[model samples]
Target: MYRVWNFINNYSLLLVAGALIALIWANFDTHAYHHFVEYPLWFNDWIGGDFTRWANNYGEGFEKFEVGDVTKVLSVHYLVNDILMAFFFAIAAKEVWEAVILKEGSLRGKKAATPLIATLGGMLGPIAIYVGLAALMGSATFDAISRGWAIPSATDIAFAYLVGRVVFGAGHPAVRFLLLLAIADDAAGLIILAIFYPSGDLAPAWLLVSLGSAVGVFVLFNWLPRMMDRGDQLRPMSSWVRKYLSFWPYLLAGCASWFGFQEAGLHPALGLLPIVPTIPHADRAFGIFSEAEQYLTDLLNQIEHMLKHPVEVVLFFFGLLNAGVEFSSIGTPTWLVLAGLMIGKPLGVTIFGWIAARPLGLGLPSGMRALDLVVVGCVAAIGFTVSLFIASVAFDGNVVLNGIHVQDAAKMGALFSFAAAAVSIVVGKLLRVEKQHG
Candidate 1:
C-alpha cells in the first residue's frame, strides 16, 4: 500500500498517465468521451433551458446566480477547472510566495537576480512569439487566437522539474534555476488570468470585499499563534485549539474570496492567492518535502501536505475533461501554440539569460554555462497542464467572439507538449547533459 501510494504520488507519472488516457480515449470514442464530460450532475433544467427565454423574462444581470441557486448543476469540466483547480493554484501561489518573499528564499536578494530576469524573458518570449505569429498570419481569427497568448507562457513545473532531474541529474544548479524560473512563470500566468480573462463587467465592490476577507484571515493567522503561545485564555480554549483550528481562517478566507471573484467577474482560481503570502509558513531551508527537517507544524505546509494527493486526483479529472479534443480540429492556432512552446521557449530563455548575465551584470551560477541554460529553456517548454486550463478559458463557450473554433485547436496544441518533451530530451543529449544512473 505504501509503495503504491508513493508511485501514484509521483506527479510526473500521474500527469502523463492522465494525459495519455485522455488522448487515447478521445481518439478511440470521441462521442463517449464528450458524453462523459458534458453529463450534467445537477441543475439540469436551469442550465439546459433556453438562454433567450430566460434573458427576456429576467432581463440583463439575471444570469448571475443568487444564493438560492448555488446548487446549480455544472459539467465535469466546470467543476475541475473552476472549483477544484482553485486549490491547485493555491498550492502554486504558496510556492511562489515562499520563493519570492520569504527571507530565506532563492529570490530574497541578489542571489536569484539572474534566474528572476530569465523567468521574465521566458514568459515574454512565448507571448511575443505567439502574438507575432498571429499578426503575421493576418487571419480574421487572429484576435480570438491571440487571447490565448498566455497559454504557452506557463511552464508546468512538475513536468519540467522531473524531466530536468532525469536529464541533468540531481543537485545540478541548472535544475534549481529552472525551478525558480517555473515558479515565476506561474506567478505571471496567475496575474494574466485575473487581469485578462474576466467573464463579466468588473464589480469593484465585490473585489474589495474579497481582498478584505483575505486581510481578515491574515490578521487572524498572525494573532492566533501568539495568543495561544502566551496561554491567554480566549473563550476557555486550550493549546490544542490553536494547533488544530489555525487552518480554518484560510478556508473561510478562500471561500469568501472565491465568491468575491465570482461576483467581481474574474476567474476564481486566483481567489486564494492574496491570502497565501499571509499564511504562516515554516522556513523551507531544507526544501518543502525534506524528510530530514523536524516537523514544524506550519499551517501552509500542513495544508499543502494534506492537499497534494487530492490535487493529483483533480489534475487527472482535469485532463480527462479538457484534453479530449479531436485531432482533425488541429489548425493554425494549434500550430501557433506548438511553435511557441517548442521554438520560442528555448529562444526566449537563452536570449534573455544572455542579456541578464552580460548587460544586466547578473552572474550565472558556477558550473552552469550559457548552453546549459538553453537546454534548461527547452525543458521549460513543457506547458501541458496549465496550458490546457487556459485554453479552456480562452475559447470554450466563447464562439460568438472568437468566431473561430479554437477550443479544440488550442487543446490539441497543449497536448503537443509531449512533442516538446521529446525535443527537450534530444536537445539535452546534444548538449551532453549527463544522465544519472541509479
Candidate 2:
C-alpha cells in the first residue's frame, strides 16, 4: 500500500521521454526513424533476429552489409526488446514470485481473493470486447486483429500505480486493491505472452537446457551451501558463498536460460523467468512500489537493485523502438484497443469484483466502497507499458488492414491509453471518492 515517488518518477519519465521523442522523430522523418530502429549492430548465428528479416525490412542494400554467412542480425531494436528487456521481466517475475510464495506476500489468502477474482474480469472483459467488436466488423476483420485481444488485458504496473495514487490517494484501501490487481494481471499477461505468442517455431526439447541451468545453479549455489552448513550456527559456508560467489553463478545460469529460450523459439524477453525462483529471496515482500524494497538483503532483491538503473535505460530504448507509430496509422484496431481498455476493463472489474465480494463471501477492503471498484478499473485502464509490448508481439508489424498498418494502429492505441489517467481522475471526482492518506 506504500508508494515510492522517486521510483515512479525515474521509471516513467525516461519511458515517456523516449516515447515522446519517438513520436516526434517518426512523424518528422518516418523513413529515417524506421531505419534507426532496425539498425543492425551485430551479425552472427547465435543471437539476434534473422538476417532475412532485417534485409526484408531495410532493403536489398542490407544483404551486401552482411559479413560472413551469419544467420542473425542483432539490430538496435532486438537488443533492447529481446535481450536487455529480460532484466525488466525478471524484475516483474521477482515481485510476482514473492507475492505468490512468501508468507506475508500480498497475493495470498483471503485478502487476495477479491482482487484475484477481479483480475479475471479485468482480463476477460478486454478479450470479450476486443474480439466481439472485431467480430462485429466481420470475420475478415476479426481474423486480422483477434490475436491482439490480450493487449488490452495488460495493466502497466508503474503507470497504473502512479494513477491509482492520484485517484484513490496513497492511504486508500483501493490503492492496495489496485496494486494487487495489477500484479495479478501482470502474472497472467506473462503466461499469455509465453503460451500464445511464441517468437518462432516450437523446439520444446531446448527447454530442457533452461531447466538444467536453473536446477544446477540452485543446487550448487543455493540449496547445497545451506545443506553443508545445516547445523553450524555461524552458517560459515552459506556466508562464504553469499560473500564470495555472490550473483556470479546465477548470472551464468540466467544467460544459459535466456539462450535456451531463444533457441526454443519462445519470447526471449521472458527467458530470465526460470532462474528467478532459484535465486535466494527475502522472506517478506514490501511490494515493488515502495522505498522499503531497497533494504532487502536477499540475493534476488540485491540483483534487482543492481539492475534498477540498467532496467531504466532498457525501458527508454524499449519506448524509443516500440512507440514510433505515426498518427495517420490510427484505424479499427486502434479503436478496438481503446474500447477494450476504457470500456471493458471497468465493467468487467466491477461485475466480477462484486460477485467475489458479495456473492462469494469475500469483502472489500475496509473503507473501500463498491463504487470504488469503478475508479480502480479506470486507473487500471492506463495500460501503456505492457500493452505496447503485447501489441508488438500480437501481430506482424507488416500486417495491413484496409490499408491501415495494423501493428502501428495498435501501438497508437497503447500510446493513447495515457488518456485513461485523465479519465480516471474525472471519474474519481464524479464518483466523489473520499481521499485517504497515510
Candidate 3:
C-alpha cells in the first residue's frame, strides 16, 4: 500500500491513473470500487453528462449573459478554457521561454534529432491518428475538429518523467531531453491552437486592434529597461515611481491583453503572446517600490503555476467522468478508434521521426532505439486535455446533439487510446528489461 502511494505520488501519473479509475467506476460497478467511488464530484444535474437536460435546466433556471436568443448557463467547458486555460498558456509560455529561448542548449543542447524533427513528430502524430480514424470510420468525423490536430501533439511531461524515473532511475539525461522535447512540443501545440482554432467569424477591425495591442506590449517590454534607466537618472521626487511604473502598470496592461484577445474570439491562450514579454525577470532587482511589487510578481508566478494544472485536471476529470463506457456499446467503431491510437499513433510518430531523421541526416539520440521511439510515440497519444478541448470547439456540441454524443465518444476514443498507450509502454519496458538481462 505504501509502495502504491509512493508510485502515485512520485510519478504524478496518479492524475491519469485516478482518471482511469473514475472512468471505470462511473461506467462499471465492482462492489468495492463503487462503494469507494465519489459521486458528489459529478452530481450536478444542471451540469452533468446529459447535455439536453443541462440545456433545458439552464433555460428554465437562469437569466444571464443572454446573447440574442442563445441563453444558456455558462459552460464549465467554456469557463475552463477561456478563463482557466489562459493561465495554463501563460505558464506554458514561461516554461517554453525558459527552455527553448532563454535556457542554453535546453532544446538545442541535445545532440539527438533536431528540435525541428521532434516538433514535426509532435504534429504528425495527431494528423496521422486523425486521417487513419477518418479512413477506418468511413467518415471525416475526426477532421471536423481540425482544432484538435494539436491534441496528440503535446506529450504530458509529468507522465513521461515518471516513466523515465521508473525505467531509468532519477537524474537521467535522456529523461531530461524527453521532458524538454515535450515542452517544445507543447509550445508548438499552443502555436497551432492560436493559428487554427479561431471561430471563423472575423472582425478585421478587432484583429488589427489585437495586433496593435500585441505590438504595444512588445514595445513596452523592449523599452522598459531604458525607461527605468531614465527614471534612475532623473532621480524622481519619489523613488517609488521606478518600481510602480515598472511593475503594476505592466501587470495591468498584460492582464488587459488577456481580455483583449478573449474578446477578439481567438483562443484566450493566445493572450500570452503579448503578456509574457512584459513580466519582470526574477533575477532583476526592482529597487524603487515598497517590496509589494516584488511580492506581487512572486504571487503572479505562483498563480501562474496553479492555473497551468487545472485546465489539465479538468480535462482529466472530464475524461474520467465521461469514460463511463458501456461495455455493451463495444463494437467495430470502438475497436477502430482504439486501434487508431494504439496502432496508429506510435506508427505515425515513429515513422515520421524516422523519416525526419535519416535522409535529413539527423541521427537518433544515443541509446535511443526504434523501440524507445515507439514508447515515446505511445506516450504522445495520452491526449486527455487538448483532445477534449478540441472536440468541444470543433463540434460545438453538434456531434453530441447528433446521434453520437461528442463528450462520450471522445472519452471512449481517448480511453481506448490511453489504454493502448499504457499497454505499449508496459510491453516496451518489459522488452527492454528482458534485453538487458539477455
Specify the highest-lDDT model's number.
2
Give every collision pair in model 3. 105-109
**12-109 in candidate 1: lDDT tens per residue?**
66676777888888789876776676554445333222233333323334455442444344556556777788998997887778777668886678
Candidates sorted by lDDT, descending order?
Answer: 2, 1, 3
Per-candidate TM-scores read 0.86, 0.98, 0.69
Error of 1 at 23 (Å): 2.2
Q: Which stretches of candidate 2 lie over 4 Å from their true place?
A: none
Better of 2 and 3 by lDDT: 2
TM-score (C-alpha, index-matched) for candidate 3 = 0.69
Give the per-residue Cα lDDT of candidate 3 at 175.
Answer: 47
RMSD of each: 5.3, 1.1, 8.1
Error of 2 at 304 (Å): 1.0
Candidate 2 lDDT at 17 equals: 91
Q: Which scores higher on TM-score, 1 or 3?
A: 1
What are the Cα lDDT values of the candidates? 0.74, 0.91, 0.50
Tens-digit lDDT track for model 3 on 251-282? Answer: 56556675566556677656656667545444
- Sorted by TM-score, highest first, which candidate order results? 2, 1, 3
The predicted structure with the larger lDDT, 1 or 2, is 2
lDDT of 3: 0.50
lDDT (tens digit, per residue) of candidate 2 on 85-157: 9999998998899999999999999999999999999989988999999999999999999989999999999
